[model samples]
Target: MYKVIRKILFLLPPEEAHYVSLFLLQLICSTPFTRKLLRNFFEPVKVSPITIAGIHFRNPVGLAAGFDKNALHLRELSCLGFGHVEIGTVTPQPQRGNERPRLFRLPADNALINRMGFNNDGVVTIAKRLKYWREEVQPYVDLEKPLIIGGNIGKNKSTSNEEAWRDYEFCFERLHPWVDYFVVNVSSPNTPGLRALQDRSFLEKILTGLQKKNQEMKNPKPIFLKIAPDLEWIQVDEVIELVLAIGLDGLVVSNTTIRRDALLTPPNTVSRMGAGGLSGAPLKERNTSLLAYIHKKTNGKIPLIASGGIFTATDATEKFKAGASLVQVWTGFVYEGPAIAKNISAASPV
Candidate 1:
């Protein structure tokens, strides 16, 4: 059914097709009868819940960060059965991201290349939306388990690296009350100089500041660092050292990669897609290896939420075997249709 629908969607630009499909789903979900019908067909079978970082996830499958940039579709997305939905990469201030055609599809590689530049409705606005969901919508949702929400935060493009910690701190404070957990995203390739925040000196300042603030609160949220897959082993070691030093909650094993090697997509075709992070099947091996490396290095002390290349039960099972406590899907959700979370959760060992 999705294959046929996908063919028609494929005719439109990737970003256009994204909103159009979600809009349709939003309409379908607006009513009780249709929403229940949608849930009946798409929700995963009930499974034992798992605890990670002191939070309960009904299942291991979650929708990754970039899917719902703002907190706009939580009600509709919750009906699709993801155990958690990560929103943002939100900045302290809203900004229009890079130019159009920034998001591209690599069908041959079952991949997507996006240079979205952390575009979002900013922290304050999104925090308000989350507050409403927690106060109004969440209590009424009928489901076997509660849906967890994660805030994925980042700095604005105009913010200098020296002052970046302020941006992260601002978002951390505003969103702390509303989200279940927080992912500090410093690895997106699209934003200029953003990846530099991953450096030990810069990263330590930002993370330490956030942690200090977190401790001041009565109930602190779990905070995780999201890293790029392209990092060298030495860089990974630095990240591990910092995570241990700060007692950070966990790690979102990867963001997307800047490297485009070993792709089934033709060189000319991929080159046309230009400079954006590459995600999907090409990312599985390296991300899985990173998960194993970090799990071993930390002696399994640091929790891992695997992202990149997970499209099926086999892919998700590979993540669990590699030491991921939870898994997130972005490209997989786009390529696999609405049943992705249900399908993966139904078969996941975790």
Candidate 2:
């Protein structure tokens, strides 16, 4: 079973283990016979195709943006049965994220803390790769299957808040043609003061700028805002208001939380890990609260993509019960492995 294998995988540094697994997955998925064999291990569900922003999702479970920062693994990721795979916290310029040991694992809690600092291959590279994905990679998969692709955009670490909108705009304009939807990421804790962009005034500038350009295009992609679960209720209220006023397509209810309160992991060990957003089992309750709050604030007018610590069918279903139209996974995928997406989709509300 995966538990035993996971124990061995856990023996390696978290970051290296991730790549090792990714490499193995890509290898298995590259061949038809092996891909089908792996597919059988994932239980299928009666997917209720949900329509949002005029796009159809065969199911509601999606891969969160941080996992595949560029589009490199879209085919491999989508083959695992996620209804969508959001790629990138991509910036205008590529940068090596934080230095060595930026990712840490809390095995006892089934969680990860990362100061990846938007480490990515950049928007131009990602966009170019995406063009090939849409043109070539996707066609080989099951037909008209998952929503399959999204671009999650953010600013470079070196960029100032005043010029931050330009970074987002750059990614937005370039990636629009290939991705199904756009998630504006301003909530990550790793980037210096990136969370400050969640401010109403600053967020308005970014969203408004994107929307203006979106309208000018003959084909406008659906755009949603991704927010941090660290937000207070008043801040959540402001975000809900902004989404409504800006006519933004939707909101990704919550990102990783900065709060380390009451975790089973000892404070000193956690503190030693240094600065980064925390995601996994500990995030479930607060994540649900924020999603339910956002749904209540908008009176369910805005579609929500619930994400935080989901690692099981029940956790993802709770997001739906709290009113998410879709859900995404990062920590959950790490914990549950390939079965994660299918498990949640099968448990989705009828």
Candidate 3:
């Protein structure tokens, strides 16, 4: 059914297709009857719940960050049966991201290349939306379990690296009350100098500041770091060491990769897509390996949420086998249609 729908959607531009599809879903979900019908049709079979960093996830499959950048579609997205929906790589202030044509599809490779540059409605606005979801919409959603919400926060592209910690701090404070967990995003390749925050000195300052603020809250949310898959092993070691030392809650295992090697997409075609993080099937092995490395290096002390190339039960099971406590899907959700979470959860052991 989605294959036929996808063909129609594929005719439009990738970014255009994204919103058009979601808008249609949101329209269907606007009514209580249709919403409940959609929920029943798409909801995953009940699986034993799992807890990580003190948050309960009804299933391991979640929609990754960048899907609902502004917290606009939580009610509609919840009906699709994701155990969690991570919103934002939100900045302290809203900014129009890089130019259009920033998001591209690599259908031959089952991949997407995006240089979205954290284009979002910013922290304050998104937080308000989240608060509304919790206070108004969540209660009426006919689901057996609550959908977990994660805030994936980042600095504005204009923010200097020296002052980047402050940006992260600002976002964390605003979003703390609303999101179930927070993912510090220093890994996105689209934002200029953003990835530099992953350096030990810079990263430590940001994580420690956020942690300090977190502790001050009566009920602190879990803090996780999202890293790029292109990192060298030494860089991974630095990240693992910092995470263990700071008592950070977990790692998201990966963001998208800047590397474009080994793709089925033609070189000229991929080059034309240009300068965005690459994600999807091309990412699975490296991300899985990174998860395993972190799991072994931390001796399983740090919980991990696998993201990247997960599109099916087998992909998800691979993540679980590599010690991921949870998994997130962005490109997979786009490529696999609405049943992605349900399909993966139904077959995954975790």
Candidate 3 residues lying further than 4 Å off, grouped into runs, are: 142-144
Q: Write the per-residue lDDT of candidate 3 for residues 60-137, one digit (tens) a residue.
A: 999999999999999888889888999998899998999999999999999999999888998988999989888988
Error of 3 at 127 (Å): 1.2
TM-scores, all candidates, are: 0.98, 0.97, 0.99
Q: Residues 1-350, candidate 1: write the lDDT tens digits.
A: 98989999999999999999999988989888888888888888955579999999988899999999998888888899888999998899998999999999999999999998888998989999999988998888854578999999999999999999999999999999999999999999999999999999999999999999999999999999999999999999999999999999999979999999999899999999899999999999999999999998888999999999999999999999989999999999889999998999899886
Can you tell me which runs of candidate 2 are displaced by over 4 Å? none
Which 10 consecutive residues of model 3 have the lowest summed lDDT? 136-145
> Which residue pairs collide, candidate 2?
none
- Residue by residue across 1-350, what tens digits does model 2's lDDT show? 88887888989999999999999889888888877776666635666768889888877888898898888887777677778888989999998999979999987888889888899999899999988877776777665564458889999999999999999999998998999999999999999999999999899999999999999999899999999988888888898888999999999867888878877788899999988888988888998988888788778999898888888888878889999998899988888888888888887783
After TM-score superposition, what is the CA distance of residue 28 in candidate 3 from its true location, in Å? 1.0
lDDT agreement with native, every candidate? 0.93, 0.87, 0.92
- On a 0 to 1 TM-score scale, where does candidate 2 land against the true structure? 0.97
Candidate 1: segments with Cα more than 4 A from true spot: 142-144
lDDT of 2 at 40: 67
C-alpha lDDT of residue 239 in model 1: 97
Q: Which run of 10 residues does model 1 get worst, by summed lDDT?
A: 137-146
